[model samples]
Target: MDRATGTTDPGGGTRMTDRLLGVRRCLAAAPADLLLERLGTELARTYGTTETELLQVDYRLAALVPLSGAEPVIGAGTPAWRCFDHQSEVVQGGALHVPVTMRGDRLGVLRLAPVPDDPERRGELAEVATTLAHELVAVRPGTDRYAVGARTRRLTLAAEMQWELLPGRSRIRPSFSLAGQLEPAYAVRGDSFDWADDGQRVWLSTVNGMGEGVTASMLTCLGTNALRNARRAGLELADQASLADQAIYSYHQGIQHLSALLLELDLQTGVVTAVDAGSPRLLVLRGSEVIEQPLDDQFPLGMFDGTLYQSQRFELSVGDRLFVVSDGVPEAASQTARYGETALHRSVRRTRSMAPLEAVRSLLGDLRAFVGSDLVDDAVVVCLDWTGRV
Candidate 1:
């Protein structure tokens, strides 16, 4: 085997390939956290060593996350940037050095001990490292490598920025309360929710921009700003949606597509007027039963000019609830099943009698259980409760 050209013994190639494929299958079948653990086990098995170390590069902390095994020097304590500076493998008796790289980008270095350093062995290790790196990028939190369709540093930066724009926790109000939680919250890009009180009414809106990463984040920012301006101008729910649609259309030259829901809650009357554009189904829960709100079913905003959207009005009573969610909620799939509308409805019914925040937490907990782990796409859950007139 040659380390330079990735040449390997016939038997070694077959074994490595099998191991890589098996690892992928295992990861694909497991939850995010379990997948990491499975990866560590696979690495140990593939390397034919029990003492294996997996490190995740964290630039912010300037440290490496030890995915598995033990390395007193590099595990949990060593700074990640320091490893990049000291490129050469660090060995201090009973230790080994193996650099993990993907498409020329150095992710981190793996350290193991008591294994001989041979070209054939190193080459095989490199192949495994490459495969693992690709898997990490694919399944990593907050990233949709396939959806983005390209690998660039900008995508990571955009994801980070989008995360910063979200609400920190579920929100509470006197007449009405609203709260939202996003799955993979740290890596979300296009999904955003906003709420504002205009003394008489509370305006709530959630938007999911088309695509992912930088483009989606940019569109979301534009839509958010448009909604804010429209609300500030005392525009109605439908008018705010129209304004947002126009802003998106003009910004993208009529090329952007976005799903949005705008709701206006009149504190004095307990009336909720809403405009929905290509968003997911909204649910209104009363006691043990859940009712689905009818949507306009119009095309997503920004796809056409002069697209008129109508607002559906519903009267809210004390203890009645509203659930607004992104497609991610119903679309979340596990290895065996998807958490569809039925599951969502059941979850909502079970929590219909709970407080607004508790209901939101219950729905989120149910979603995580149904999906069996963190979701692949961004899941946004906005729960609103009407507590009688102000």
Candidate 2:
């Protein structure tokens, strides 16, 4: 025990502990707008830094919006995006940018300035930023200030409902990587993808529910949840699809339908069993080229009360990829030119070397750009890469 510093070592362990506790203690009391502001202040006081700022990646996919301080646009070819893009810190002359990511979502960048000259403290600074990111994720479900910061425009009720039902935007494991993207972020309806990895298998589904706005969102909700219920109840892949079809048909009756691909994948062996309901062919990317995996197509959900959905089995290699898309991809009109299967496959080949999230972004981003930045209908792209690890 040290006398003056109240710690065993001379590295100010006790002070750091006190500051961490202080930040946690203040977290519960601060309002949304002031949340990061307080964290920055506490960090500055503890680290002897001149200034601290937090920048969030806006939902528009363009600039980095600030929660409290100055708004900094991530200029073209700038290093700022590298912080969020690469999940690594960017250290410069006076300012340092750290990626504040939790799981696979690139939340934003934590920027601190007038950094100390000591190299030994980099880890400590990074830990602080990382902890803050975790705290933000935990608190976000109860508050919308972070969403307020991230949004570029007002979100529609249907888009909000759809987004609320989604899992993490991306997931990465040693044996596999998966990412999903939805377009018309502010107004999308009923286009959703969900997945789960239960050690032995990964369950995946992509659905496009019929109708518009809230009605479409409700139909999607019913379909996705019914599938989840059946799967979680230990039903087979075919049964899961059947249960979803039954639920939607029983409630919505004729005319309300969904195009879907429900799958069960063995994590260790790379085997895929799928039930396609007006679903596009599963595109498998091996090495640099993308190929379509053929499947026996079934009826879309709600098309019939007694549609017999069958499971088709296939095996994937170590580097194989799985792609699932809604009808929006092929139907999306860009200059009166739809995104045909050939172009979509070509785009995947072009972005094969990028990270899973980057690949999804590239695919969706290209589609949006081609359609003049406004997709008339909802579009989704789900990518999965199997690394065949033990």
Candidate 3:
């Protein structure tokens, strides 16, 4: 039987059509775990392969965790790492790997073995893997079992609270694309990101509150929601920042404060207005160089009861990329060295040619490799690419 086309799919129709129909039917009937297991088994039998596996990304361990609870999970140095790290299909040895991605976030990799050695054939197999991934993501939003399986250990109260409050892990729109990841994944605190586009303009923000544990996470959540509320009310950048600042100072008093950066991007003109409340800075990449964009200094939310926040505007040229990093990247320390701002600039230079989401994944992979251990602080990187296409 030809690998590309057998007599017929198991569903008694042409190979591609039957495979997709079968997947949709499974989606309508099976739960998350069962769906994954069934898909793996079906792929194995369909392709006459000896082994296949579905692994979800466990960012805490920086490892690929099996959804079926299998042993001997892999990550970092293998093809699974390359597939997700580069956000591209990878064919190496007898293994074929493809990233399970939706929006800008990389969910994990789909792995198969005993596949045809031809590069073109392997690419086709990777497409099948991606289709299966899309099917899984379609059903994943309404369930918690997928999230539960992705974790390697129990989550702390603060981590749980923060995770529940997230608008999403990543987002993609026509005018721009943004991606953010928080770590240690199962025990993060005082770090989060949010963004949305309202046809004409896009709103972006990142927050890192002072202190640790549940209280810190709660404060960040309040601060983030306050900004969202103000934005929804059609407040300008300065007013939105002020509302968040006033809410935190009045409600949490002098003890709690959060450093944040709020951005309003004009979709049509490629102009960006920012409200800087903390140490977070905006860096733009152009032609293999990372240039630091100056942002106005403002008081961190809750620092002063009546602080006035100012908005600083910058114009973006076509294809300019913006990076907003939590203090974690620059402050990170590896076994042999500390990851600093200069090194980060060099990294952006190295990865400048890749798409926004791919550059983000690559940079984060490097950070995890440098840190050696799970990050000690909640490191958040939000990347935005403005093509000025709108």
Candidate 4:
């Protein structure tokens, strides 16, 4: 181990690229339970350091729990948390913390103590973290180690279903950035979000189911998957809503229905076509002003069979930000007032200078502070930023 450089090649003269490739190979071969242990060992061998650990963000976003160690859990304001929050590297007390993210999804952070303050070595460490993140995503389905480490508390059955149904907490692309969060994460029911991009257009949806518990989860599942099926079949925005409406109607027979807000963003022109089917609200922040986009209020999904849906088209400026929220957000009430009337607007305005992912997290945190108790219904917020010129 070289104390000054905090780097080494166990093979004596191995190139950094080759070392990274070897790390990838090891990750591919390791089982889920041993995955992080293998990564730590490889990091120590490739870059001399006293400690190497992976800290995964908890489901509630409150803490970073270590994957394999007796180390204390990390919380906000720490270097590891900052690395995860900013999607960048942080160094403090001669230790390095790098984000472990795949695509736009953030899984956690990689921490290396006593790492030298060198940009080249830091970048290489980032590459190693990225490779580990990709491997974790690929192997997560076969085991529960990562999932178990991500949870600070047990999830309700409905919450588990909703979490599984999510595409991801955030996604980054050339044309746009999108992120979302659900309130009362441990026991959330009914509220869910989905999005897909097929190069030309990005489709986004938010569903607020009618009931609670597993019933609400199933209701949302039906509507969201129906929309996905339609979108995958190459249906446009309105028809996608129509198909989901028909599916929900068939399942509930007018007795149960879910409110949804659907959007399709044209990657080339920055035009957004939307179907506002229920109580969900869409707000746009252009420059410093935040304005609620008023769309024609159509019938909620499953309200009746063959509910003809219409598309409303609007253009987003290159720097515009969009917020799509389920009814749970506006309807969130304290003893004195509803969050929608004033607090929601204020919170949205406060997030104007934030990135899409951080904005979503901040807004949800504000909601939690205002409510100050377990949410009776699920609350969801999705934030999107249009960069144009894809």
Candidate 5:
């Protein structure tokens, strides 16, 4: 370990672990606002890549904007955006664009000019991009630069709470890849999503609270935390829902209720245990066929005291994709009619070739286009692919 940098370099050889630690060393001392600058300096020192740039996906999940507050906005279908969307390296016009991602979260891209075509170099650059992503997640809460760079508009207090409450927009694992997002980014309320993977299983939930604004935000917060508290205590699906239901009921005294869908996927077996408490919707796509995964309807959370919840079991094959959405997506209103079943089914099928992260984004984009304007209510969408790979 270097006493100055607080990072270990086992021998002087240029191993990937050593290089990753070196990047961590640079990040360890970097302030939030200077993380990208420090990363650029480290990359230059180590790889002699001086023209590297960090572009972060904005809050709306639309485009990639430079973290350095510079020019050259990268939009969808461009090299940088394609790199981000596809989560791969793209070389165009003598520049290499690499996706900077942490698990399922699509952060942005790292662009390096005049790079070699060597496989080792590609691996190292990809690792460096991933390392930067992990560091950004750690340093994000401490700095405003990340948030500011990603936002094109101010967030309402409700939207702010909803955004902060999310674990991330996407997650990738050996067994599956999951991605989720909420709509009306600037002022979303009442709708939120959460997930956790503990190697053995992944727990996912979508909450839809009553009303709008801060009141709804707070209600959602209370319900989500209650669910979290139960899950963290090692409770099963039914108990987690039951506890959250009680908490909400106690808080609102039956005056308010929130709908939720809680799912637990066994990573090793592909078995799913679910609890459906009122709103939100679930659909499974298997072999080009879209089917709704049915669950017995129960009272919404907080509807009444001592409401018992039951868990239903199902299984997902390796090639299956599951979509869980709040009512906002299916029920979104247009000038003529609702963005209903036919449109929702078509939209989901349209994204069949894309990744989970891109699928959710495309679905929301379709919703926006169908509505022809900003959404009147909050919407949330989560997509999970069961790869079941060892």
Candidate 6:
């Protein structure tokens, strides 16, 4: 309600209410590019400006992306420090200058040049800039909303590509069930889960590549494709591991490593076969007892050619559960503590009595509570249960 910065409207509540409603509409819309376009149009119209530009901060690249209606006067990939150093927004003659900021973060500066005769509209334009900044912060990206409009289009496209490669929410068969979830859903990278069934056997793999963003995503994509091809060819667990390792080595030249687990389940005998390579530990639950699978220090996938991997076999009883996960689950840490094996053991025990899908949901909930937030790394959980009735 600070009128000095135009936080409150001159006519009191009506204009402010309309602006809030507009923000709500923006939030409800699909396609971030469209939303940003709409926001830019509204800002230009409301401020009576010939042009309005939005700039966003890219933390990964340490640069700003410019959202401009005009071409090339100022563009994306501008240095953040230079903008701050210049205290950007002062125009030489007829141009208006305004900085778009939210909380203490400077999203980007807005440049609007008015016609020569309209000197009186500067305050109105400044007010609009302030309101827009607040609206950006309140809706998406929270404290960094100013950057949202600038990065929305490209990020949205990338998110769509990521979604296209992901598995369904749940994969159900006559004998078992599997499900997974990724944290910070819109920006997830470096976590992938895949499953293939050849009628005689079911093969499942979960992989977490090092680091994040496009590079990690590409590595995961390559490994996932290799896994599918190897399994479809009916390669034995060791052969499949070798093939996948060769593919990774050839593709990345030893630059990346994938913490992976490849599981094969026989539909006829209810036997679970697995190969664990530097992954987070897998948990097996029977009755009231929870046991960790013996990983035994195998090298991660893609590390070296001819690295031998051995498969471990377990008999699956009715109502028994298998929990496969990426490090994102067990390694999730709050400011003070890590969600270690002990916490995971207790969570799995508490949910041992639930249906496979419900148990997976409960386990993830418990993990989130332990971490105190969504995990920083990509987290994935694949739960398999043997429904004795099948």
CA RMSD of each candidate after superposition: 18.2, 3.4, 4.3, 3.4, 4.0, 15.9
**Which pairs clash in model 6?**
none
**Which scores higher on lDDT, 5 or 6?**
5
TM-score for each model: 0.59, 0.89, 0.81, 0.94, 0.92, 0.58
Q: Which consecutive 10 residues in model 6 have the weakest lDDT in total?
A: 69-78
Weakest lDDT window of 10 consecutive positions for candidate 3: 6-15
- Residues 210-254 of candidate 3 have per-residue lDDT tens digits of 888998898989998999999999999999999999999999786
State the displacement of the C-alpha of residue 115, model 3, in Å, after optimal TM-score superposition.
4.3
Checking candidate 1 for backbone clashes, the offending pairs are: 62-80, 142-187
Candidate 1 residue runs with Cα over 4 Å from true position: 1-156
Q: Candidate 6's residue-wise lDDT over 193-310, tens digit each?
A: 7876656677878887786687777778888888778887878986787788889988877789777888888877778888888776688888889987776567888898667788
Arrange candidates by lDDT, highest first: which order?
Answer: 5, 4, 2, 3, 1, 6
3 or 5: which has the higher TM-score?
5
Candidate 5 structure lDDT: 0.86
Weakest 10 consecutive residues of candidate 1 by summed lDDT: 145-154
lDDT of 1: 0.67
lDDT of each: 0.67, 0.79, 0.77, 0.85, 0.86, 0.64
TM-score pick, better of 4 and 5: 4
**Between prediction 4 and prediction 6, which has the larger TM-score?**
4
In terms of TM-score, which candidate is strongest? 4
Candidate 6 wrong stretches, greater than 4 Å: 1-161, 388-390
Writing each residue's lDDT as its tens digit, candidate 2 over 236-261 gives 99999999899989997867998889
lDDT of 1 by residue, 65-158 (tens): 5654333233322433334334335444565655555543445566564554554555555455566655655565544432222222233565
> Candidate 3 at residue 33, lDDT?
51
Ranking by TM-score: 4, 5, 2, 3, 1, 6
